[model samples]
Target: MGQDTKYIVGVDLGGTNIVSLLMNKRGEVLERDARLTLAKEGRERTISQITGSVSAVLEKGRELGISPDSLLGVGIGSPGPLNTKKGVIHFAPNLPGWREVPLVEILTQKLSMPVFLENDANAAALGEWWKGAGRNTSNLVLFTLGTGIGGGIIIDGEVFHGAWDTAAEVGHIIIHEEGLLCNCGTRGCLEAYASATGVVRRTVKAIKEGRETILTDWVQNRLEDITCELVYKAAQKGDKLCSWIVEETARYLGVGIASIVNILNPEVVILAGGMIKAKDLLFKPVREYAKRYALKDAIEGVSIVPAELGDDAGAIGAAATVLKRKGLL
Candidate 1:
């Protein structure tokens, strides 16, 4: 391979920040940079911010005596729903006023290089499959349990973009016909019960309803102070409410994964995101639930694992997007 094909820039764009990394085929990060997205500044300015961040990274590479042409191009992982076919962002709730922005074309024009766009969760799944926990597996599913739950399914080393390029939304899979109200106007979507927000909601409600717990001591009825991290900490201290909340959330996650296993039969299921940082307290229960609920045969050889890429999963996956877009995979 030539030098140009040896390196790529990965861009992870979020509502709050934009993280860029220069990486090689083996997943080595050579240089990294970050900037606040300031998305409220409006679409045009946000695009400019993205453009400038890429430019600055390229310039930094040049200053290190790296030839500009040696760069493969840029891979962008952004919040969706996006039009991957046309490289346009369909609608990103985090970024206000962002609608139908032709992100890929604009960046290509500005940088004079090819650009590839993908949903952040899908990109993260690809990233893990390529260089992280899901390595050596042809089929896999990834669930990111953070402020929200995002999902991606990788089948045969490729992201499964269903009709209209919006597939594998496991987070929205209805685990309960009549459960918690979801942000999507539905009842009991997995995300509505399994996300950090969901966990905190459950914890706070328990406290408000007079269920005994240590969480109340932290902030009495201050819902804003209730978070997954706080719940994890409380659970660590043996808080009954926090512990029960986690176990309940894990049950929903297990149900969601069981459905994915029954449908996709992937080789592995990857769990990533801030909430997973709870480690054994969260993971052990999730694995137990999956083993108990998932199809006996479908999960026979399946492995439930934690993601190795951590916070950089999206950025690295964005870089992988460049490779897949170029037909390198």
Candidate 2:
């Protein structure tokens, strides 16, 4: 692929879904498809699912004047603890069957195209840096606050993958020492207090403690059906308990981000994920607390913003990885 290369493929691999996009160098997605990851079906089956989705998207692209051979390459953003240099998913806590899977090598061999891979959060950061909120800056940090908190750092205009490809595991930042048990078997990690699961856990714990709130009624006294969305809605309706839950989560989130600022001092912090849809409910407290904790010199000129690419960030970033490797981005 050269400067004039017109098409590339982006694949976003998640615990629950696999989304593929056929896109041009200009960032316009010409075709797309998404399906259940079914990772439990094991490594080979998941790989087949991903390749099938990519083929479907390419078929759609074929309808748009681009032939199969016209494609430049394929890029993927996958759940980590992986080695980008080796193109392997070292391990994914949420992906049951994934352990040291040589994903990029397999995909490259099967697709017969140059294939690139990065952690999904890192890919989202690259996507945002290339085409979304971080577009104007050379240094940026992106924290994806979703099922789990995932982060990526861009320094001097490039993704910093670190020596062992494990540099930016921001979610594992320990905040409260032994405060709460995390999915990773650690205590008091930022993910325990800020993710969707964390939010729900906090709310349920509050309800269990006999704290009076609208969430109790909203969930019909059943904690199993409670969600972060339900809690946010209750907060919006003036529920003090729910509001406190969100505000407190934001504070923990802010502390985690402030630590990043103190260390990396990136241009901006981009917060992404479904929970961020609450907008000010989450951003306001995070800024307030982050400002209180981060260094005056380090936090200066740094701003917090939500991701602009929405759900397409993964796919776009996946493509951007290939483009960057090819010196086209």
Candidate 3:
């Protein structure tokens, strides 16, 4: 590597997997590595996995003739309720026994380089804003719709951490008062309706209540076998009950997005995660309902689109955090 060339490593830490990337300031990814997180094994094991991931990436960089000095640092996108300013993860529900872990300090000490941390969703939003669907806009909102909903807000080219670094908890936005209970122990949260888990939960409940659907037959009366993707497939096959569920999920998402639009007026709203695989089946209804509910001016010119980065967004965005902090992005 040239003396003037520099690089950074970004790690996306999840309960199931850890993805790490070696990237340059120019947004070029040079080497990538992935491994299981083994979160249930305990905090010490998970931390070792994280450090091992970084080491693997750095070793790969060495093989590419990249000097260790050219590597600036590592950035981690972690599940939180974390204190980014202090680099402490207060608690992570998915990671057993992860409480007040000084991750940045630990990783910095282990790697002998600066380490930065951000909420995973926020890192993904930064990734999209920098190189994915929201690349053209400085202000954006991103919703990752998987087992649960996660969100990030980007304002004027930066993640909006708000006063306490938890400003954009979009999933918990109350879309339906007195509605379904959410995993977060809240009532009527958007996550309780639109998330993949929420969708499957509602579907299973409706089936048990004797609502007719192809999903029941497909699952051979095993309601537990039904999934959000299976629900979408049934809906696409013209199952009336499944169709209604999909539409209801889309409407709930639209309602949430409309509320966000009214308040933030973001340039673009990007939807990511597994549910996006439904594509037009999901986007069409969501866009329509958002237009129906949002203030006319607020809805105008705001684009709701799918994210482009896919699985790589979290790691790329994590790296972007490092670059942004280093004044190199």
Clashing pairs in 3: none
> Which residue segments of model 1 deviate by more than 4 Å?
1-5
Which ten residues in a row are the worst by lDDT in model 1? 1-10
Tens digits of lDDT, candidate 2, 1-329: 55555789999998889999998888888899999888888887889999999999988887877888878899999988888888988888768878889988899889888898888888999999999999989999998887788898999889998998887889899999988999889899999999899999999998899899987787788889999888888898889999999889989988998999999989999999998889998888899899989998998888899999999898899989888888987
The digit string of per-residue lDDT tens for model 1 on 127-193 reads 8998899999999999998777899899998999998888978889999889999988999899899
Best by TM-score: 3
The Cα RMSD of model 3 versus the native structure comes to 1.2
Location of the lowest summed lDDT over 10 successive residues in candidate 2: 1-10
Candidates ranked by lDDT: 3, 2, 1
lDDT of each: 0.87, 0.89, 0.93
Error of 3 at 105 (Å): 0.8
Candidate 2 residues lying further than 4 Å off, grouped into runs, are: none
How many clashes show up per model? Answer: 0, 0, 0
